[model samples]
Target: MKRKSSKVLWIDAPDIKARIEHLVEKASIDWVHTERIACVRSGNSSARAYARIWGLNQVWQQVLDVPSYYCIEVLSEKFDHLPEHHKDEILLHELAHIPRTFSGALTPHTRRGKGSFHDKLKQMIAAYARSFR
Candidate 1:
């Protein structure tokens, strides 16, 4: 029997990082705490991108040894194929998951309630639109 490798390849793509920086500035969100953005090829196809509190787990920290408030992972193939605006939208959506507190933690989406993920997405879109004006 063959064992499946759990290791993921993380690529530092400056172009993607630049886009994230522009989006953060335009969103007027204090994301200076974000330490890194990397492209990853996930086995799951439905996932476009995601953000999470980085280095919070001691065991994983010992292995990776990087300190960061947030780590955004863009699914390599799917994210790369998107248009610029779509990429921005997806990245913005992931960033919206971070709370205003700027702590190294994630604000999980409401599963089935008033303040659902969709609500947050709508608010993020509205804010992004206002940033241009």
Candidate 2:
């Protein structure tokens, strides 16, 4: 009998990194400029989302004695098949998870039971579009 392997491989994604930097600048996401962000693409992920943003939580930061950081990983299978504008929207949506504090904590879909994450994302996407004009 042959056994199946399910190893996921992650590789540095310079293109995604560039896009993120451009988005941050164009959308005027000032809080992101100060945070350390790493971008990567993964293969063989079974997750349903096109991309995911991972945070270096406070507990890990304290334990490792390191500064806060975030990782933007796009699932190659789904992400590569998407159109450019959709890719930008996906990235922008992931970026919306970072709170203004940039403290390595993720902002939920509904923030603090008051602010709506999608509202901010829509505004940012609009700002990103208007930047080029």
Q: Against the true structure, whose TM-score is highest? A: 2
Top candidate (lDDT): 2
Q: Give the TM-score of candidate 2.
A: 0.92
Per-candidate RMSD vs. true structure? 5.0, 2.5
The digit string of per-residue lDDT tens for model 1 on 73-120 reads 777756667787777888777777666655445667675554677777
Model 2, 1-133: lDDT tens digits are 7446799899999999999998999999998953499999999887888999999999999999998899999999999999999999999999999988988999989757677889999999999999989
Lowest lDDT sum, 10 consecutive residues, model 1, at 46-55
> How many backbone clashes does every candidate have?
0, 0
User: On a 0 to 100 scale, what is the lDDT of residue 40 in model 2?
Assistant: 96
lDDT of 1 at 3: 54
Q: Which stretches of candidate 1 lie over 4 Å from their true place?
A: 1-7, 31-68, 111-114
* lDDT of every predicted structure (CA atoms): 0.61, 0.92
